[model samples]
Target chain A: MSLETGTGAASDPAAAPEEAAEADSLGDLSEFDVSSLAYGAVGTTVFLALWQAAALAVGRTYLLPSPIEVATAFVVELTAPTTFTVPFVGASLPATRLTANLLQSLLHYLPGLVVGSVLGIALGVGMGWSGRLDDALTPVTRFLRPIPPLAWIVFAIVWIGIGHGGAAFIVGIGAFWINFYNAYAGVEGVSTHLREVAASLGVDDDLTMIRKVVLPAATPSIATGIRTSIGQCWMIVVAAELFGAPGVGFQIINAAQNLATDVSVAYMAVISLVFLVSDGAFRRVERRVLAWRD
Target chain B: MAGLSEPSASEPRSDDAKVVVDGVGKVYESERQRVRALSGVDFTVDDGEFVCLVGPSGCGKTTLFRTIAGLEAATDGEIRLDGDPVTGPGTDRGMVFQEYGLFPWRTVRENVAFGLEEQGVPEPERSSRVGEMLGLVGLAEFADAYPKELSGGMKQRVGIARALAVDPEILLADEPFGSVDAQTRDMLHEELLRIWSETEKTVLFVTHDVEEAVKLSDRVVVMAADPGRVSEIVDVDLDRPRERTEPAFADYVDRIRTLIGE
Candidate 1:
């Protein structure tokens, strides 16, 4: 026992001396650790400095507005109501508030995201677990998964009649495939040995086994799928609304045609801001759910 | 089919055998060829007996273990527990895996309670049984700890506790100590013995290690590869706390090694 403790206490004698020597040379002050927040601050500062230099070099607000101009445009866009002309009806629509546009985008985005993710995960898990189902679904998914989300816009316009529903259809398609592949890979990647372990412990039935073992084991992958879709769906929302909808994307396009480039940049910034908030919120929840990983 | 903790009246009284392996064989068939993993394997583990299946790399010990556990069906013959045909994994048979297949998401206590929960044991009683199992494995202090935080030996102990939670008539262990360090393996062997005596459950341990078989087993079944079949059965009447350095222990090891064509 004494010998064991002796070895443990002097486990790294060679390293210990070097550490002492280094400590003497360095004095009592500890090494400065660059935290994530500090790194973010430095990165933001560098980015703004470069942007300001570029704006000064261009000296053209219409081409590339200065940071100050864009900031001022952001404030104007945040408070101002937006209007769209109905070309076919020959009538001007009522001016919609910025908050209303944001809500309009979410109206479709959330439903599209929830429904698509739920269906994708369900299909992925079902096909992965059952050999018969996998065979039947493989070819269908293979053919469909390759088609891009934007490619569905024509169908969305025809089927959904060009509204928030149409935009949601496009967004849903994008989220679906991402979540499908992730969930599929997750379920497929589960260790066969772990299944046997579950069986040995009396988790014999298929449904119970899936619930008790397979789902929990595949959670990390499923969580990754959900988080990825959160960001991917946001990208689709901005692009999906380019047709005709009350969202930040439509606002950007409307501003750009009028030579209000700063307003366009402001809308783009709002998209980025919205994405950051959602992604950050998701990460916090993801960390809690996958606490077992830590 | 019954509560594993209580032995029924019809439980194999005359046979005194907890497990009976009768001419069991498992064959895997693919497109090109048919591979016979266990060909005409026969063995029996009596109630409260400590038996070890020792063999070389390609041996069907693991295959046979799985067959008994009912995780894999024998292509020929059958395995019986308490004189009833073994269909699939039930509360009556529990297993310990080599890789320590404890659910990383669950605490040690929850893991121990897993089988019991499956058995539909409820509330306060389940908690008490979990407590007892943790105490039995000497992991009571670490009940709330996750599998990731425990050492290899501790994880194996939790595995054992989980298996024993449902009070299975037989415990099948596939190289349970294979991953632990040498000193920890020795400590686990002793802990297993103590638990075995205390619980009085029949143990069917499979390993490639000859010394481990000699040190722990009441009877060691030696197996060979190439169609994978049992070649010999050696009875180890060695006393408790058997030393690896002893000549008798060395002889037993030599015998098993020779039997497996080592």
Candidate 2:
């Protein structure tokens, strides 16, 4: 009783070594888990080793490029300038590196992602809430869902010409289906009790009930749909550009046509890098919007 | 139960009652089977009276309560409130659910202000009412907290605050204390009684607990399970601040249990 642990008292000596040991165990990679980072590094090292072994055995860059050759080609693509066509404006513009390529690809990707997502969610909510709309749209959706997004390439080229509009149309179709099912399931999954609660609280009207109760309750699902489409659109964008558009995918095809596999692989890696950065940015935004889920 | 003097005066007269549930019945029929939730269930609550509809799980007390709340339509008879037939959910009736139906996405203050917003009350008055209701439920300090951040008892308190925020003529609470622990249930019972006496709004509380019924109700209407009929109505004439440990309190609980054939 004589000794007291007063406010802002001196720290315990026994805990100092424990804290020091903890700090020593976790020196760097503080932002991420150290063991998981180690495992990822190990995985990449193993993959590169296997790839190098195969390349050395073949002893040919044209057929199978080494990791070093591909890395050097990647740096060249990052810095080199090239000639390209501006899709809608019909102007041939000189641009440097992957920057212009990514920007042009985004010009198509952004519009397609937005338009497809908006239309899909709107239609999905309508189908879920009203039986008549569901019956009318269900048959058409089932027929369209079977056709691959790539099949739209011929129609896209025919309708909008082989340009950014054509590529964007293909990306839009891919994004449409991803968001459609999610938004439909989201609205349908709204709990009956929640609707009853809304009714008892003076929100008996159909419009207010959907807006205040159904939408907020289904937001987690809707947000997930948007996130999934963000990545799916990226996949469609590269393929859409591969057919006949000016972007990283076109760069890959042009290099491969000249039997330069290293350059093709370099551009493929660039697309992956872009996807990683964009997906990471999206995750941060999604977390903030869906904070209620926590 | 111990007989009290002049129980008839406390009985709800059709002309003077706040809620008159006359021969109300609810039947749910599907292709597979026909289920009757309530049959010939009749009751009335006088103006400002605190009544509890006590029954077992399948007794259809909830169906009857929902009918009065205007969430469900009765297949037979009508529920008249203030001489008007209950058509649908309106501003005149506020309901508290067992699961504390406060929207998880909304803050405590916003949840309480939901009905007010629906009624189109202006910002100044709405804020004042929300502040008052939160204070009444002792949740003024936690006004900005979400429902997920609260305990079971506090969530129900938010539900009560939200229901009373609109100042309805009748408060319908369907097992408001059902999710809370026993200790918190006792505390909520006291809080509900205080709020009821202060607001003077007629309350139709539904619960399966016999002790809760005897403690809170001016009258407890025991319901039967099969066919969901009204078995017997027990007149609880206990004085204010009735103690659960008292012999008379035990007698009232036992009388209701026997009436329901428990």
Candidate 3:
């Protein structure tokens, strides 16, 4: 198992000598061998230094803001209050700019991700497991799948109006296709041998066999789809907000338009930070769910 | 080596026969071709008897096994279990696979309890039976471990335990020890013999290995390829804990090897 190999590599006495030899050969690089965390710190420092040098060369804050300028703008966005009007109730609430934008983004993102994933997985499994359903849906899905989620922006605006609902519709469309294909492929690719085994074991009906055998076998693949959608829906979140929705994407576009480029960069960093945190959280859950794999 | 014995003649159905495979044949047909996998295959596995179907690749041993298990339909003839025709897979027959087909997601204990759960055996009985099966296979310690955590031998033991947990009349093992190492295979052979004696369940084991069939089976049904059919039925007239080094054991192996033209 990976646990054994992982621990073996970490504790191997032979590895230490080779690592020491490599460190000695590198001179100044030996100091960086403290840990992966130290290496990450060093890498970030080098990246910031390069960015600072490039920003100095450009000498235009509007064109390319220095890391310090973006940091200042990030602090300002975090500390400053923005008025958020509670929809359907005219009460106004004060939240930091970062918090307000994040909440606004989540207003569409969470619902879109949940609703789209549920429907997509249900339909995908249905189509995959039933030959009749597959035959019926294949042509329609083939036609619809080629059209991009962004292409539906016109419909979203016309039908749902320019708000959270429209943004959610777009994000939902993106999530739907990713999950659909994955669930479909997962169910389709379930081992015939396993089905036969289930049959011999007195799991007579398809539904019982699917619940006991097919679903568990296909879980790894389905999990892959869900994990992919978690990160992918974030991209969709930004794109959905770009068209007159009040979120981090809107802030980025608005700041860029006003030539407050440092504010735009800060908002972009917020999106990255949010995505990293969300992805990491989902990964932990996925690991626990799929612990059997290891 | 002992002289070749007379092939057993096809007799009328006896009351002792637990499984009756009468002229069972399977044909795989498509637009391009129709392949006769098994033709006029006949055999009888008596109650509490250990029978091994031995053949090479394309010999249709597995096809016959599947047809008997009711996992696949026979194009011709019928397989009767306790005088009833097998229309589909039922709880009466428990099958173990060469691949050690334990669900990876389930613990070893859970895998053994699957058939019992399907049979709707309640909580106390299911848990006890699962524990009993695990103990039978000497896997009591690894009960909570997943299939992936075990070796090939251990996995097949779990498969065997799982198959036996339901307390089926017959255990259908499809080359279960075929993938394990030789040393482990020997140990498993002894374990299987002990389990067979303890449970008194009729066994229909399939294997390509002539020695494995000779080692485990009370009767080895030799099969031939190019439209597979039973070539001979060799009764292993030997004592329990039969030694591989024995001349009679080697003779049985050699005779069966010759019958399969291998």
Candidate 4:
């Protein structure tokens, strides 16, 4: 999801209070399963029917790939032997729609994510724990924070070429700041009383205190950073592909450039699927990690 | 000044007495002002003695404890643990904070073992000692549980267990039961007394609660807060399992409160 869509999706339950004062806050929206299901079913049907009717009126399959045509394209992609050439790894092996493309994206995304998160957490926590260091670093971070991740595309390309290196660099840049801010906030937000308690316990050394007390207390915020980075990494994957990498982003860009609208939409769907499935999986992991929070 | 003995570290003492604070005073100086937190505070405790420093807020009861624990420097007095000056905090001085400052990420067992581990105790002995302390604090079931999962009282139990695991010569508790509710505080008081009886560690507990001091302490030292001076020292002499509603309890609490006011 784009940032706005992610935010909007987040705000649906949050904004119901504004939409209707009398709405049931506690009552489940899915309480009446039949009605809710029917509402969704009817909405989908009406939307597709209207879209089909509009396509027919336009009388051009190229301009408005019919829903049926798009479905056929999706099936074709599902059955097709999706293969690509890698400079280092010979001809890519045959794999399923779920495995080949998805795993390829993960191969690139995971390394960048791990590296970026580790660095960000270390830097953020370091600055947060020390007054002198934080003061020295604030101006530099502030100066760099406003420059968008895409703005770093030129540097990323120069530093790491146009393959996994470049894409990972771009993805890392996208994810780094979110975690940096979150980890910084986490350390700064630790309760003073808690620090005093640690001091009284004879664990007054800075590193020991942070590792033992501050980090645990600030976990909820750190989890937020991780979640935010997950979303950003997915976004940058697409952007990275646009810059000539072998992820879904590159697939989408390649299809769009060729004016293969059906293929473009199919790749878009793939991107959405990757984001949704990965987000859900990460959410499960995050809940388990922060089980101590609540 | 009648019952208050003058500064005399050279005075004869039995082998049973373990800690002596003679002519101790604390002066905090800043760019704008100077505050003398304590003055000529002389006290001594026998091993296994339960002494409570009772006072109003900011009375420096906490400062006195910190000084005794070697966590703070006393400007003009000497604190001797078994006739040795307190240079710094050591394994012998175990401290329990009111906030139940057990490491949130650590299991109860790990937190209890922190002090022993710091002292470089071997793993087998550390684990056994930690187990023993957890049992002493009635937290054996919570050995694997994290502090966040435990209630306020249970967290304090972990804190108590952590201090006890070190096998300290003395336990310095700064309002250790202040954060818990009345019922839990009462329960913990009983638990603490039992632990104190069993382990025989000298305890210097500081609290603003008059009745708590009277309930747990063998002697209650009340202090007044403005510049923080010792007001009076009352010998509780009440038996174990103190009766809060008893006339003597009420009388002691009222007397201490009034002394603090004056």
The numbered model that scores best in DockQ is 3
Kindly list the per-residue Cα lDDT of model 4 for residues A1-294, writing each as its tens digit: 233443454567766644333333222343466578889999999998998898788877667766777777777777777665454668777675535666667767888887888788888898888989999999999999899887888987788788787778877877788888899999999987566555545665788888878888778888889888887898888877877777667766777677767766777777778778878998999888876665
Cα-based lDDT for every prediction: 0.84, 0.84, 0.87, 0.79
- Candidate 2 has an lDDT of 0.84
User: Which residue pairs come into collision in candidate 4?
Assistant: A241-A250
**Candidate 4, residue A126: how far the Cα is off, in Å:** 2.0
TM-score of chain B of 2: 0.95
> Rank order by lDDT, top first?
3, 2, 1, 4
TM-score of 2: 0.91
Whose lDDT is higher: candidate 1's or candidate 4's?
Answer: 1
Query: Which has the better TM-score: candidate 1, or candidate 3?
Result: 3
Candidate 1, residues A82-167, lDDT tens digits: the string is: 66554356566665456656767887798889988998899889987888999998999999988889899999988987777888
- What TM value does chain A in model 3 reach? 0.86
TM-score of chain A as modeled in candidate 4? 0.81
Per-residue lDDT of candidate 1, residues B38-65 (tens digit): 8888777777888899888877888888
Candidate 3's residue-wise lDDT over A185-256, tens digit each?
999999898888788778888899888988888888788888888889888888888898889889999999
Q: Second chain TM-score per prediction?
A: 0.93, 0.95, 0.94, 0.92
Q: Which residues of candidate 2, in runs, are more than 4 Å off? A: A1-32, A82-95, B1-12
Give the higher-lDDT candidate: 3 or 4. Answer: 3
Best by TM-score: 3
lDDT of 1 at B229: 86
iRMSD (1 decimal) for each model: 1.4, 1.4, 1.2, 2.9
Taking the candidates one at a time, how many backbone clashes does each contain? Answer: 0, 0, 0, 1
